[model samples]
Target: MDLDCFKAYDIRGKVPEQLNPELAERIGRSYVEVTGARKVIVGYDIRLSSPEIAAALSEGLRTAGANVFDIGQCGTEQVYFATSHFGMDGGIMVTASHNPKDYNGMKMVGPDARPISSTNGLLAIREGCREPLGNARQPGELFQIDAMKPYIEHLLGYIDIDTLTPLNIVVNPGNGGAGEVIDALEPYLPFEFHRVHHTPDGNFPNGVPNPLLPENRTPTSMAVTASNAAMGIAWDGDFDRCFFFDEKGRFIEGYYIVGLLADQFLRKTGGGKVIHDPRLTWNTRELVQEAGGEPIESKTGHAFIKERMRDEDAIYGGEMSAHHYFRDFAYCDSGMIPWLLVAERLCQSGVSLSSLIDARIETFPASGEINRTVKDPEHILQGIERRYLEEALSVTHTDGLSMEFQRWRFNLRMSNTEPVIRLNVESRGDIELMKSFTRSLLDDIEELDGQSLRDPQLSVAL
Candidate 1:
């Protein structure tokens, strides 16, 4: 009866107490009722509870007269791929991506693999799940599907394979689902892979799979340097987001990767719209324009970016959080496609990954993302906005409070699920200025809140 598992974008919470097989079944039946999806694609991640949860969910869908195409033990994007690729009416991926191992949840998408968030049918499904179940209709058929082959082929379509020469790359899945995908694609590529924590382990023996954490990056970074690899990549649990490291074992901030990917996508498409988050913009905007593509800014989050990409028919969309969305992949984010394209660029340009990113870093320096747990996020945000409103050359609220001055800019936003404030600062060809503004902003925030701030953690080095 406890349906607290439903969240703004997806269902995520502790197992059993917050989410269980019984509740999952109800959700499955409710999904069919709310969206009227006749045929649905179902998949799950590497969590231990995933298989049972997925099976119960399929039973509910079948009882509701919806045929279920089950893609077993896959990442979230695989469900997205299968749904849209097979022309299914909807899709559901059982995953608590990057969450603690004790938790399990689901991400759902409607027809064409469009996300179903609170604004759409998520709320309705939650409400429907609370009511008593009706008599079962004629049960629909269930079919096992192997979606990996076509999905892998679709990923290969992103770049010219013949252009890719042999190179060494380090891939750390962090004991998540990405290793399986890399294994599936290994034979088709020319690169030699040095894998770290490459198995699919639900226990997450090497800590949780989030590569965003500073500590989690050490293994991948060390391997890249020790093996003399050209580049390194890491993905979170369920592999929805991926992070990169250059030849020098230096972590490349996701902000820079957005710009790099935009440039690559634009070059291939000749010219198309590229959607980017507003948190860090100068680098992406400049590269997009130079590549003869329009740079469209969207509010942060996968749902908003995907919706914007659909509206604009964008060739690609990227968030500095490492979620890269491709127009061809049902506008869903993929951990696999990004590294492949980056590798292809490496081969074609004959330049190191660091070389490709260094110029961009110098042109537009950023503070990356700094997270601070504030006593009052709204008060802090409003106070900062009031102080900066006068001197600001421009202010935008695409996602949060973004103010631009003559030479530098900063964005301050509150976290959706916590009382944490995220800050990002950037300057036009000035790293020192960016650093200075970042320090000043933190000082201002603490002074306004009248509380000593916690030691802020930077998601990436300046």
Candidate 2:
């Protein structure tokens, strides 16, 4: 078995080459063998290849003597819901999640919807699937079912229905699986949705549903401005993570959303614990402290965050990449819950989204995540650290290498799932300083990438 498709968190790869039905089936058997899960729930997203892969996975699971619940065409979060809500031993979601057309992947969770990742279990599954030594047992039962209505009701529970105000909002599912849930929640809420790319088109006529890209965000931004919405929200293909834009059509960084949400939850819960990733930390830490909440720092992946949240009995957990987790929700991340909480915050505060985040923006300016394909990411990271170490105030490797200076700090790390390095820079109440250092860093990266260094500040997109 060629295990090139197995990643740190999930199994993702290009179709036919890296992922196919045979591999998925073998993986399904491996999952049951490795986890000893007798009951499994399976789902797929709005990808052309997802259905076939899911079918094969379910077949393999059943053949391995595990009963399977076939919840067709749902978001990754729905699998989390089914796994924990029904008390199943395991769950699998077939999705590439913002990857290009030829790509597909799967996310798995053990009992209680807790994540299964490389640090804990993924690599072991990879090893188990090779050679398929498990003898065939009597096939287990497979049942078809729908988990949407229950999932939507759970989402509504995150916000009080009576407290919501009538506000127009722009919603872009990007032709992914989120449109279904949004439509289901419409009749129960007072908000009018300006829906775009609302249908689940597997071919993705509007391109893959990744709102993190600057190009992918323009549609949502324009829709917000044109519709005069209170805010705009966009989700990835699997709808596991969601992005935000204010009424003025300005994109809000996911890092600040972490702080904003921490403020809202902390105020309501009256000083509980909140877990945050180590990527862009200053704001989240300060916001949690100011709101009288304890901020716990965790490593920058779902598995790590979930583990830390469970250890601390945290009320909530957030990552700068838009993944939000709730203790009430089995410590699994949700794309739906975060936005609902934000909407409730807007309603209660009676303030525009831009105004709500303006002060925080000015107080902690940041360069949004920038990615560059590099030949040797390790070399560049080492070089950057060597150049900045002399003047650094503190250095930490909570997730990646994070170096803090007097006025500014940045994190440079390799993506666990992609062939690129991600860079994030921020300054304490100084946008110019952030901009200048960001430029300097990017220039260094370009030179390290073996390309002729052009000016990194050609335009200030952030």
Candidate 3:
């Protein structure tokens, strides 16, 4: 077994190469040994390779003396739901979340949907999988279950929509498993929906369903504009992250959605602690505080945020990456909840999504997020830290490297799963200053590479 398959967060790789039946079977046995769980729930996405991988994994689990509850063909959230809903000891979701079609991976959750990351139990699983210690003493049982309908019902319980006003809405499932869930929920939903690429085509004819990419969002934005819809939503591969487009067909930053959801949760929960990623706007912090709740910041990534939420007992946690986690939902992120709340908020306020986010935009201007490919991401990050961060700002390395100024802050960190360094800059309603600072930093980065940098202002305008 290749150790490289075990990523910083989950077990992921190219299908049949890095991820195959043999490797999945080994991981199954390893998971049983690491967690010492008798029964594990297994789920997978709509990818072409998912069925085979799920079977292989279950085979390994049964071989390791663990009964497997196979929840066939579902999103990552469904696996999380099943793990907690059925009181299973652990769960595994075979997916490649937002990655291209050629890739697939597994996300593991312990009891209560708590994630097992590299630093926690994933390393042990990796090491154990590398060396198989034979099969189980006896064959374990394998059973099948349909968790999607129940999962949809559970999501619907989070929001009240009895009197939701009908409005034109657009949804792009991006050819992922979300299409099936959306198909089931649309009839029950109170809206005129315009769907694009909603079909579950494993070929992903429309393109990869990752709305994080500017190119991937083009279809959703165009559809929203053409249909004159009130709002538009797009989901990633496993339906864990959802991206939004306003009525104007402009992509809304996930930070604003975080603040919106935080407000909604706070309204219902009577002001508790809210956990958020350190990447984007402090508007979420302000919103939480204004709602009489404590605001806590965590490192970027779902695992870290979920762990922090559990520790702080946060009512909810959100990241600018569009991953929203709820304490009521076993501290697991759900792509379904964010859009549901958006609809409810729109209905309650009788306002458009643009109108709702416009007020916050005035107070909290941001540069969105920027990803730059560099020869050495670390050297560029160190350069920025030594020159800009160490001298004038409060610095921290909770995720990669984050620095806060008096009124503006930015996080520059190499991606744990990719080679590029991700940059997120936010300012206090100063778009000009944000552009200047971003350009200056990019200029610094380009200087290190001896290449003339492009217009940073232009890069951010989009």
Candidate 4:
């Protein structure tokens, strides 16, 4: 087995070769051993290999003296729902998320659906997978359950049914796992959904199920425009994150969605704490403050955001990558809840989605996220820090290097999941300044790699 498959946040690697059934079973046993979980929840995405891997994991957990609550073929968040809502000791979702077809992985959570990442317990699980396991006193049980009804009920609880208005919306699951939930919730919602690539086909006829990619978004955008949709929502393979599009078929950055959602929650609760990732914070922070809510910054990633949310009792947390967390939902990120809340807010406010966040988008113009490949990402980061140290108001190494100046700020960080370094820049109401900073950062990155860093098409003007 390839030990390298064990990642810091979750286990994702090429299927069979790196994450075969045997290895998956071993991980299941290791999880039970490490978390001392008496009972666990397990689910799989629509991938062809997922069922076998999940079964192997179930075998591992069952043989290791733990009952397995199997919520068959599901999205990642469904496992979180089953684990926390049913009060399971732990949970596992066999999914590769938005990764390519060849890849498959698992995301785990402990009691209360809290993330079991590197700093918490994933490292221990990795080590435990290397050790031999003795036979258990008695094999545990496995139970099959349908989680959709309760899951849909819980999602609907986030919004008032009476407040919903009829609106045409486009939903693009990209033939992943979200279609199931959307179909389940259709009967209860007022919005007219225009679905594209809605089937749960593992073959991914339209391409990999990642809506974050520019190419993957075109179909959704076109469908929204054709259908005259008020908005559009797209999800990755395992449906852990959801992306948004506006009435004009324009893809809205998650940075602004974070701000919009923060305002929605703050207005309801009459002021509460909100958590947001550091990658794009100005809009969220400003909106939070304006809404009489406390803004808390957390390191990027679902694990960091969820833990921080629980600690701060944050009503909601958002990341620009599209992962959104709710305190009432066990402080776990959900792809389904975010769109639902946004839909409700849009319905109640009776304003175009574009109008809601347009001003904020203009006020704190961002470069979105620009990625660059480099031989050594750390060296470039160090170079940036040294160059900007004297001219900054402050510098933070929360998740990456965040340097703040009077009129502009930027965060340049190496991606944990990929070799590329990601840069996000925003200015205080200066679109030209944000663009200029983005260009300079890209040039510096290109100089380091001796190749053009900016991919013209991937770069978006906010």
Candidate 5:
């Protein structure tokens, strides 16, 4: 088995070649050993490889002298739900999330839905798999359970759709696992659903079901405009990330949604702390403050943000990457919660999604995030700090490298899971200045790294 399958957040790799049933079984046995859990729950997505992986993993878990309860074909969130709902010792989800169809991965959760990343215990699990557990095989009973209905009820209890007014909306499930949940909730919703590719198709004929890419969003945007809907929403493979589009079929930045959701949560929770990533908008901070809640900033990624939320006892957290974590949901990020809040807000206020987000658009102008590849990522980051951040602003190396100014801020960090460096720039409502400064910084870094734009393909990919 390839060791590269163990990633920063979870175990992921190309299916068949890098990831297969044999490897998944090893991981399952390794997880049971490292966590020392007697019983483990398992869940999977709609991907074709998921069921096989789940079965193999269960076999491995049973071999390790542990009981396995299999919740067949569910979303990643459902796996988290089962860990806490069924009172299991630990759980594992068979999914690659938003990655392409050729890839597959596993996400592990400890008791109470606590995540296990590489730095936590993933490496130990990997190393434990190296030595085989001979003659330790034990057969455990397998049973099926429907975790979806209870999970849906739990979500609806938190969001009140009855207070919403009637509106037309389009939901593009992108052929992932969200279709069933959306279908189950439609009858209770106060809106018209113009759904596209809502069926769960693991083949992903509509191009991987990732709404972040412009190409993947074309279908959702077109449906929104054609149906004359108030807005459009799309989800990733496992439905962990949700992206939005306006009435005119324009994609809204995820940063703004963060502010919108934070505002709503603060209103209901009576000014609890809200957490946000440093990438996109400071408007989230301003909104939290205005709502009488403390705002906390953290490094990007679900693991980092979730850890901070737990420490601060935050009510809500959002990242520009479209991951939203809620206090009610075990402090784990969910793609389903943000849209539910948006729908409820639209219903109660009698406002369109576009109109609700307009005020935030004017307040927080961002250049979005840009990624570039370089040989020496650290050297380029150091050069950026020396040239742009040394004299005028405060700099911190929390996740990557972040520099703050009075009116403008930017974060330049290397990817923990990949070789590329990511740059995120934001300013106080000045679009042009943000663009100009971003280009200048990119040019400076390229010159220092002695690299040039070798691939026009990168531009097309973004």
Candidate 6:
């Protein structure tokens, strides 16, 4: 009865101990009981324990009188796509998403593919699992579905295929679920793909498929240079987030990609609201404004971004963490759409990815996201705020403490699940200024760490 798997956003934990087929089945039933979903879409990733867990979950769904559409072995987004594409009542994806091989978990969404987080019915579902429900009057049926075709077609609709010219592109799925998708889209596209670790392996031969790590990015970067590909793209285990590399084999920061995507989406939508996170703003805001699109800032995280997108009717939303949301795709983030749009832009503009991103990087130099482990994250956050609040031109608490000044800005936010605080600093086209402030902030954080230990009573309201 260990329900530690239930998280702020989704369920994720060590397998068998924290999560297993039994709990998964109970969760499936609980999902139906909480949401009253009569027709549910069930999908799983390429994890070793996924098939058995998914089958058990489907059984639980059936027991709860909810019919199950099993889209076997797909990415997390596929569940989102299948759920909304076929108008299912809800969907659940059995995936830990870049977690260790020994771990397994689930991501759930209610009607219209809206996420079922703790703020919604996730906690209620967790509670429901504690007390099992009796068998329903009638068990529901199970249907195996091939959502690949319609899903791929829907993805292709984002960009004009006719406009895409033959270009050499490097794609590294890192032995995750994205290779299957790339293979499916191969016949319809004009690009010559240099696929690295293209096979979908539950063992994750190349690693856990998290391209965000500096070590995991090496293979993709090398492949881009070795093959002289136009650009390189790498995805996480579930492929909900995708990281990019330029022709020169350099990893492009996700913040820059956010701006690039905002501009691209705005051009297509002919001036629509584009939502971005608060961490890095100058580049995205400037690009969005230049493209005649309204740039709206939302608190970081997929749920927050999607909800804001729904509220504002945004054409697109992006995070510096690599999740890109689209209005056409039911306000869900897609790993496929972002890359395709970038490739299309490359083809149309006849420019290298580096050329496009370099300009933006120069216009807005950022320190990227730097994480620091501290004794007291809250105290450090408050200490930093106290030091900077007096002269700050503007202060925002959308997600974290974001203080903006005349020439620079920084966001110091604590991690939800860890004792680490993440800091992001940026300047108006001044790399030295950005670097100087980043170092200064790091020093302040280091000093605050000691100060907090000495004076625990030093409290400042957020």
Against the true structure, candidate 1 reaches a TM-score of 0.96
* Candidate 4 residue lDDT tens string, 328-407: 88988889988988899889888998898789888999999988867667767777787778999999999889999999
Compute the lDDT for candidate 4.
Answer: 0.89
The Cα local distance difference test for each model comes to 0.93, 0.90, 0.86, 0.89, 0.84, 0.93
Q: Write the per-residue lDDT of candidate 5 for residues 218-297, one digit (tens) a residue.
A: 89889999999888999988888899998988899898899999999888888999888876648898888988899988
Model 1 worst lDDT window (10 residues):
453-462
Taking all chains together, each candidate's TM-score versus the true structure is 0.96, 0.93, 0.93, 0.94, 0.94, 0.99
Model 3: per-residue lDDT, tens digit, 1-462? 466878888988998889999999999999999999888999999889989999999999999999999988888999999999999999999999888898889999989888999888999999998784688779789999888778888988877878588889899989898888888888788789898988887788988888888899899999999999999999998998899999999999888999999998898789899998877747898999999899998988888899899899999999988899999889899998889988888888888899889888878888887888876666677667777755566888877778889878888888765668888887888878888888887888777534313433332232
Better of 2 and 4 by lDDT: 2
How far in Å is the alpha carbon of 15 misplaced in model 1? 1.1
TM-score of 4: 0.94
Candidate 1, residues 377-427, lDDT tens digits: the string is 877877788788999999998888999999999999999999899999999
Off by over 4 Å in 1: 451-462
Clashes of 2: 0
What ranges in model 5 sit over 4 Å off?
A: 135-138, 451-462
Candidate 2 local distance difference test against the native: 0.90
3 versus 5: better TM-score goes to: 5
Better candidate number, 1 or 2, judged by lDDT:
1
**Higher-lDDT candidate of 1 and 4:** 1
Ten residues in a row with the worst lDDT in model 6?
Answer: 453-462
What are the per-residue Cα lDDT tens digits for candidate 2 across 1-462?
578989878989999899999999999888888898999999999889999999999988988889999999999999999999989998999999999989999999999998888877899889988865464568888999888878888988888889999999999999999999998999999999999999999999998899988899999999999999999999999899999999999999999999999999898889999999877888999999999999998988888888999999999999999999988888899999999999999998899999988989899999988889876666677767877999999998887789999998999889775668899999999999999999999998877656322423322211
Q: Which residue pairs in candidate 2 have backbone atoms (N, alpha carbon, C) closer than 3 angstroms, thus clashing? A: none
Top TM-score hit: 6
- Candidate ranking under TM-score, highest first, comes to 6, 1, 4, 5, 3, 2
Q: How do all the candidates rank in terms of lDDT, highest first?
A: 6, 1, 2, 4, 3, 5
